[model samples]
Target chain A: MSPVNLSNNKIKLSEVDQSMKWAGLLFIISATLWLLAGTALGMISSYKMHNSNFLANLEWLTFGRIRSAHLNAVIYGWCNNAIFAVGLWIMARLARTKVRHLGLLIIAGIFWNIAVTIGIIGILTGHMTSVEWLEIPTYITPLLAISYCLIGVWGIIVFRDRQSEHIYISQWYILGALFWFPWIYSVAQIMILFEPARGTVQSLTNWWFAHNFLGLWLTPMGLAAAYYFIPKVIGRPIHSYYLSFLGFWTLALFYSWAGVHHLIGGPVPAWAVSLGITASVMMVIPVLVAAINHHMTVLGHFREVIESPTLRFVVFGALSYTLVSFIGSTMSLRSVNEISHFTHLTVGHAHHGVYAFFTMIMFGSIYFILPRLIHREWPSKILITCHFWFAALGITIMIVALHVGGWLQGLAMNNPELLFIDVMKGTIPWLKARTVSGFFLAIAHIAFAINVFWIVLSVKNKPAVIGTKALFTSPHAK
Target chain B: MDWYYYILTGFVLAGLIFISAVYAFHWALKNGQLKDLEKGASSIFDDDEPLGEQTDYSLSKSNYNLHTTTANESSKFIQ
Candidate 1:
């Protein structure tokens, strides 16, 4: 694409109002800080694994602290807050409603940051919950829950007082996630912490909460962005309203029960595991529907996708959802989980969901919002393409390395007589490769941070240039 | 936790029902119920008037007096 100019098309200033700019700017600031925190911790975690004594003496910077810090910064500080802010802001714009109780949103943002701050402190001080994805201490969970409640409440208000009555497809996903997330979170907490539940209930609640975090909350947020950005970029209505609705309902129906599949081969009841397997398989229907709707609708307009970074990331994200769901269901099979469980394969599976699936959506959503929210186009299209390549390559290498390394480890462990060092030797190469490629990913993330910073801070409007280019266009202009 | 499982089982069951209802609503919509929902009430009101009922969803034409204003506007755009 040529030099991107900002003036010709005359941006919708009402869309880029002060409230939007402020909220967008704050989110960017939060994201950059979170990136720094997540990256530093990630590198430490990587290095300390191979060289155990690298940071062994530092109490606050131990591997566990860094891991929890990394997770919290990336998930809560970086990903969720940023997406929630952008999602709610965009919904307001599309619904043609002014932001309500602006002070409340700012206060909520403060509460959000405070909660993360305390969570990070607790994790570093060895006060973690020790549960994967529930590492934040009990004291901090209430704060995060309250902040989320406020944000969801604001969304309901904005959606309720809309200019138009016909609810858009995007609203369905966002609204579902907004309401459903609390149900999953609160129930899990109440059972796990406050009141002890009966036999197998803790594991059931744990898996239920963890699964819904992806299925109900993260997926909906991503899908909402998908439903909105896809049509907005393509400049066409969804191929079929019926199909979009079908995908929504099927996902809600099927995604919940599948959480139990994660506990396959564990002490969970037989019926529960079977139910999870059934639901996991049933998830294919919604996945297929959404895939066809997103991919087919953009089929004839391939050129636009090539030039547009937003579309590129979103398409990758949309495709990854299919791949991840497929992988998730397959891994749930008893025979498969027997080998893959407790192996790095599970790590690869997770990255497929988190980095490949959800983070891609976050990346795409940020790209789509930066221009509208900040009133400036990205500094350069080349940087955007470079960022995607590095990220895609990094995640690709990480997952493949882990999968292969894990299969070998699984084989070695099965021998029972094989030395643990033998398993380590086989996987060490991949772990090293993961560290190396992760550096590239770190750079890509920094590149993205820079791009975001420029968009939010730069205000001098330049001459507008046509920017109909899709993301993966050949760098022939090189 | 045992009691919680029972509650979760209820949640699971409720979620299934909710999703089914949403699908059913969409099925009705796909069958062209929502686009014509305005007619459900408007037709009742139109009965009192001498104008004909809205038999089709071709809002492109000002075929009825009750909707002549919207139909006429659409006709101008069609040109």
Candidate 2:
């Protein structure tokens, strides 16, 4: 064995980390700050749902604006920035190449954050486009799209000069996501906002864009992180090569069509809705294949899963992906959609996929990637532990409350005898529960931010402990 | 009339993605991209372990095997 030098190799190992340090750190810090802001906005919006007059007098804090602000902040500000950090780091490492255009990436990241900032402010100030996830105003969309191009092209360039002859599954997903996001964004923007699709067609385009944004952009990126981290941490390979390929190709083939299922009973053509249903059901193949592969690989490694912070978060995300995708497929059925559509169930379902699955996985990737980038160790395991528990419990409470409460609300609405006021009243308690859950999530975010800032502020406080057998061998190697 | 354009765009985009995927899959197959399935999976460990050394799968598998065998032997001895 090569003499493992904690002191000497630490400097050597960090050459890779130094290539990405500034851009990666900036993206992560920015993403965590947005997470805090989003958490606050989410809490306010949930409170307003329960008590309509909580901030009724404030025009800026109205439910519509606050909720839109929360979504944009988390999706654009938080998730996109995190992906820029985590995704690019993974691509560079896997390709065994240093990131070029570091300066451009930093500029693009700054511009991207600035665009999201202005976009959120625009939404709050009533320049909002009111187009679901695309509420980031017309002016800023172009800026974001341009900055994203500047940032995203680096991944492909890195791959072009890769030292590794074989492209790993993670690269395929990352490359695909980088290509897919701009196409979907531009198409949705042009059709829905610029030219303006007529009536229900606009709604179809909206759902199409919204759903695929999650499916293609966030889902694949999240899965890519999980695929890379799980095997690396466990010191084992994925279960089956064939299953991985099937999962990827089937996902690429079926996910785009599954978007139309969002407009199941709408004025859209029945043929279109039927196609959506078929495609949604077809999603089971990919989801199950991925689930089986992950589960079998980690089957005997439960001890590692419990010990490693990264593995814990990632395995939770992998499990939630399975759960959420299954629920989503069933919900697309006509009978299920009858009760679930136009209800809080869909809202809960969205949080399940985006928060529980994607966000948790992103958190995992950050934990594993950040230390390497900074050439240091996390200062506080207590903070990390607390953050995990708070987030897990918070999202769980929110999802359960929303789905069950929404079910009753849906049933009550279907009844001709029941007054609408009573149905609204019925959801108040659940919304209140959701508000409390938001506070838990807020605490989690604060803890995470503190942990990050503490490590960053004291970057050189601890000696470089990387390149040791202990830290690399086990997740519990603190 | 514009709605037809929207619908047509969707179909064309879908067809393009489908065709691209097929071509990529064929290319991968022809180039032996999928031959050593285990290699790519093990490559991620480069960050965790010593550089330039691919993880030995058979070694790890045998370790796991030894673990289970020890457990079985212990249980039998206890009985």
Candidate 1's C-alpha runs over 4 A off are A1-19, A461-478, B1-79
Q: Which window of ten consecutive residues has the lowest lDDT sum in model 2 chain A?
A: A1-10
Per-model B-chain TM-score: 0.40, 0.50
Report clashes for each candidate as comma-separated counts.
Answer: 14, 0
Q: How far in Å is the alpha carbon of B5 misplaced in model 2? A: 4.4
- Scored against the true structure, residue A320 in model 2 reaches a CA lDDT of 94
**Candidates 1 onward: DockQ, in order:** 0.04, 0.15
TM-scores for all predictions = 0.82, 0.90
DockQ of 1: 0.04
Residue A70 displacement (Å), model 1: 1.7
| TM-score computed on alpha carbons, candidate 1 | 0.82
